[model samples]
Target: MKRSHSNTGANPDVRVRMRRLRWTTFSLVAASYMLAFFHRMAPAAIASDLQLAFDASATALGALAATYFYVYTLMQIPTGILADTLGPRRIVTLGGAIAGVGSLLFGYAVTMTEASIGRMLIGLGVSVAFIALLKINAAWFHDRHFGTMVGLTLVLGNIGSVMAAAPLAWVLQFTTWNTVFIVLGGVSFALAVLTWLFVRDHPGEAGLPSLREMDGHEAHPPHEGHWFEGLMTVLRNRYTWPIFWMNLGIGGSFIAFAGLWAVPYLSDVYGMERVAATQHTSLMLAGFAIGAFSVGVLSDRLGRRRPALISTAFVHLLCWLPLVFALPMSLAMSYSLFLLMGLSAGSFTLSWACVKEVNPHALSGMATSVVNTGVFLGTGILQPLVGWTLDRAGTAQGAAAQYRLGILIFFFCVVVGFVGSLRVRETYCRYIS
Candidate 1:
């Protein structure tokens, strides 16, 4: 009987092993997200080539780029629920497979309509990756480590964004854009297989103990509310709404500008060569990667979120004013200001911590997705809105004027985000363990 008890006790050690396994699984999941970022933003990297090839207008190109966000926004709420119900392992695997096919189709697309279809599929497939990873992290690691972990993951995944910029440009120089996407699609499919073979939903399910349990930390049992009720609870929570709006405001505009229009704004308006414009884009992405990782570490160390959130938003607000008011600046001045824009824009990195803090442990996936949905949805909507404004103010010489209007709109978003930040109660003071 003592030996039997000993064997049972050893099960916890196995569960502990699964915690390490979760990190491995998350790394692959993060890789898949990087692929999605690559494909999602690749059009921008090769925007000039795409425009010439397809005989596309700036507005048409903007719409094409925004297609991913449209499907991505629509998928978030449902994907959050699915992640909670079906678990990250399976959902991410399926997402990877679907996204892989989408990338392949996108590479093969002969018409704008076909390309749009591919973009939509990619959005649908990749939507689950981030939220699922967040769910796994929230479940597998201590809450105290959540923000830092997410930041690290984002930094890693953003390597794809870096690749999407200049490297993608360099690739396009040697190969047709279609071939680039075909290879990306195949890679995504392989990642799907890896995720399926290795990832487990939680440490317990893998015959291992939860991280908290192993560390003498008490585990919070997963929430068991009806999905609808859980969602409603998330919606009704006062804290959740503030973060959601904050993301919609600041995060939306940041993504719209940085992800889609920044290249065009630089090339067409600022008179930089296509290659130089792309390099500027790369610089912004690099800054974002650095800012996100740094903010995550600092937020965790200080044990406070509000100061970081407020400071970043205020800086972002200040940054937008320069871009809107100062037009046709020298290339050096524009690039310098854009670097600051990237740093300030990265303020939304704090939204993850804010979302995690306000919700029940089990609801982290849903809560984070809910806020993220706003960001992507805003991206989808604003891309076209900015494009339309630019089209209306049409002329190569007038591009800066139109861009100024778009930047003003972004300024409004930053102000609203600041207001939302004020409404949120500081959650860093609360202990999650």
Candidate 2:
């Protein structure tokens, strides 16, 4: 990988210079990831409009929403390889361009088939962003701070999710959803150009001293393992499987409920207006954003993953119990529980850090991507499955019953995640440093 040099002169205050570089890098990477989140999730924000426009059923809507994940799941390994080999800078630049084009296509799409194609393109384009950002974090930050940094990045990037909720709804009131995507697509293209021009692969390549070097620590070389060998290593590890399954369950359930159905579920079942439902959904994302940052900081501060993971899972399990009963509850109560769900569910963002810690340094990309695969794959399958169950149930009231069943299923998934979390060897006590 090649690096850029802003200046070659020896600095009087090397620490200050390094700090500035780190922040700049963090900001750029976070922005790119935010755009990826925007593209990945924008569909859900406008699901109601899509169903009306296309005159599609709930199952069809779910399938369309899951289209992004379908391609994202398939690209995980390839993205991992690209992140490792080409480095995050170039891969993310390319990804942004692809995503930008896809968004434009989606904006222009008039039919469900066209929309599906656009969604797939958007998925393929943005699929590399998260893993690539993780690769950059591993390159730039100290190992001890890795989990917290990843969590912080997720916190900032998920502002896209927040925007995808009420803000998007507000935007739609002024213009069509298609126009919003068109504008977003153009912004994505510009960001890609900036990434290509400004982002460097690593500190050493940029002719600046690496933090490890500055701190009198040795930097590890890239692992020499082949892709298949790296894959096998990740698969064979007992610790890795637990995190993988944990992500599959926790992330899957979170994405299914919060990302895909929360708004529609509120509107259709709770009898809230679309705008109110979108706002409530935004509140859920706001809770997630806060939780993601908090969990990361606390995990780093406490140096423990299991307690955070287990506690959050338990909270998430409790949140679902109320929804499953579906007794006559105030809208305020439902929103509060949903916020709790988001906060509890956000703990899974720690899974990326966990995956990075358990795998060898050489295979961090592969390990992270593999664990993430379970997340997207599970969402892709479950979103439509939930919708299908509701469709089969017939009436709106019946659909609410079906959704309750889905929540119960999600509760079971949280249990699965809790068990998987326990299976993993606790890494927080043994700092990556």
Candidate 3:
């Protein structure tokens, strides 16, 4: 009887310790994810600065920024595979360190070629973050709460996007953009250290029960097949391809704009100051973060996926129409429109959840990574395409007219994403097969 009582008392302490450890691990990983967002979107806020520093044209600038997405696009599947095999802690730690070194190289780059190489390294390193975070979420959180956790993860990570926008513009007023990347490099190294010291791949690594086991349920079975076979399985699954296309359309266009083109669009077309332009991107990113959180919670609560995804996607489609048409707008109206566009675009976050629910549970990383590759692939294509279009448009057209073609390209992609949302298999927020 005494022994039984002692065991019961010890269990509570263990549970508390487990909870603390998981959150510690999550916080560190999330911090690294924030750096990824910062690196991605920072190029836009400092576009003119880059031009002045490098003596680059619009096409060259686009290529420099797109370099990150190109490498990131290629790395997604491999990162996913590593996340599954190596576990999140080791990969995230290594990723953060490499990203730190990349940032330092970028900060000190003397030419566009050097900067591109640094940017490529940064992309290669940070590409592991989101997939690894998803893997960590799967291990640490309840299945039912996966959507909310993903939403929360995106919300937190988008804070870095927000920082890269108006706040980055503001900081540039006092310091050079080079200084910012250098400081961020130091921060990445610090996070790498923290992650290695505290993060465990799952509760088991910390000597605690799996979440399922703690709930008196069976734990998810480990993947018995080879990792390559498991990846091929995810690729062969018909349900997986739709979300990949959906991400390509929505996630790709959104990042292309916010990451490199939005500030320039506003500045070139509307005569807005850099600070004012960044303000629009900042609000847009904030809306995106909020939208991500809301979509996740609402989808999980309703036990449905298609309705929210379809509705939000339709809204996103409509938001693109105004920009593509170059409609007249006051400052207040412009802000509202950009915010609405971002809020609607937030629906894209559901693609990850949707893809994960349809594929084998053990291959969650690979499955989600496959779709995520679509996002960067789209960005890689569109960023340079927009710049090429803008350069082709030439100064012969007025600045306002110059951007219409680029915005039209964005609108066309969003339409494709909206269509893709219609075909996503409804998993009812669970594994269907």
Candidate 4:
């Protein structure tokens, strides 16, 4: 291949500068991604405080938490489109601003309605972060390194989830949830400013050669058609739909449980204290972070996608069995199960790489976003449905029975995901379309 002018005569100094600028850009956007994870999972830690503050029922509480997923579900495709069209830098900066305002509003709200609106805004804002981040990764990193980069992204973002778990519970001992959210809102605003000042969508925007060009390969061409056409192309593909279903089943259930119900389930069913319950969630989130990073790197190294995904999905489904049966578990057993559940749940992270690989390289954002929609959609439906199940089962049946019923919903979702995993196409760690 003839070296493009962009890459020709690119000396060691220029390559070194490119590396610094890209990493700097990635870090700023990633900080925003971290805040998004924190907001997504925080409701679980503060479930009781929300109930008391809003005088909310279990159903209402579920609705309030699901509000985020609902907006997130609706926004995924649009965010993907915007990521491809407007670029990751602009959308992520805007998303951070919206999320910051939402957090501030949520922190200050006194009424249930106000809180719900604030939560919705938070969802809408953070919805852009994941797709935008994925687009950035695809643009900045080499094709072979895509999975590892995504894994690293998940590792960093899940740190926010880790913070929202046991750490938030511990913080509650000394401070109100309101104060925590307010401080987070300020952090979100700061991230927005940093993103605007620092992030570039790709090396091209910074007047540098693409990673591929630096590696002596031609850079992938920019999209030549309308955004809608690109999106339709992704949608029209048969491979894309399976990933959506897989995500709906696995990813949705993970967030629905950990985001709002895990703390309550541990507290109600096991009669554990809030802080103690959060420790389990923290372990789960940490396991998820580790598992995500590990799975991505492993998938890249193994040069295959399906085997890891299938094995993890199978294990994830098996881990849910004890929860559905409401079996007795020692403290050690409980911790082990939650951690294993999280590790196995990491299987869903592969869906992004799988979906992207099966689609046109130019439509990676849309492809990943399409499948990402299933995750939030599943969560939106499952969260409220689980609550409704609990409400209908009522305290008359006892907390254990009620939660068992709620958990069965998750069990069903896991089964669906497992089946989807079996159907997933192996991409051998490269784009096929």
Clashing residue pairs in all predictions, respectively, total: 3, 0, 0, 0
Residue-wise C-alpha lDDT for candidate 2, range 1-433, written one tens digit per residue: 3222333223546657666666776677678788777765666678878998889898999899899999999999889878877888888889889888888988999999988998888899889888988887887888878877888888887798888878888888889998988897898899899888777767766666665655555556667867788778888887888888888888887877777787777776788887888777777778888888788888888988878877887787777777677766797887787788788887788888888888887678888999999888888988888888778777746646767766677778777877787776678733352
lDDT for each residue of candidate 1 in 1-433, tens digit (9 for 90 to 100)? 1123345445765655764687787788888778867766677787777778778887888898899999999999898899888998889889988888888888898888888899889998998888888887777777788778777767776688889988888887888988988888888889999999888777777766556665555666677879888788778887888888788888888778777888888776667776888888787777777777777777887888888778877887887776777555777877787777777666777787787778777777778889999889888988888888887776754666767777778778878877887776677823342
Displacement of residue 7 (Cα, Å) in model 4 is 6.1
Which candidate would rank higher by lDDT, 1 or 2?
Answer: 2
> How good is model 1 by TM-score?
0.93
Residue runs of model 1 more than 4 Å from their true location after superposition: 1-19, 327-332, 429-433
| Model 1: lowest-lDDT 10 consecutive positions | 1-10
Tens-digit lDDT string for candidate 3 (1-433):
1123334335888779878998998999999999999999999999998999999999999999999999999999998999999999999999999999999999999999999999998998899999999999989988898889989999999999999999998888899988888998899899899999999998878777777777666677888999999999999999999899899999999999999999999888878999999999999999999999999999999999998899998998899887877777899999999899888888999998899999888899999999999999999999999999999999998888999889999888988888889999999988885
User: Which wins on TM-score, candidate 1 or candidate 4?
Assistant: 4
- TM-score for every candidate vs. truth? 0.93, 0.94, 0.97, 0.98
Worst 10 residues of 4 by lDDT: 1-10
Which sections of candidate 4 miss by over 4 Å? 1-10
305: Cα error in model 2, Å: 1.4
lDDT of 4 by residue, 79-177 (tens): 999988899989988998899899999999999999999999999888999899899899888788888888899899899999999999888999999
**Backbone clashes in model 4, listed as residue pairs:** none
Error of 2 at 137 (Å): 1.1
CA lDDT for candidate 1? 0.79
How high is the lDDT of residue 374 in model 2?
83
| Cα-based lDDT at residue 374, candidate 4 | 96
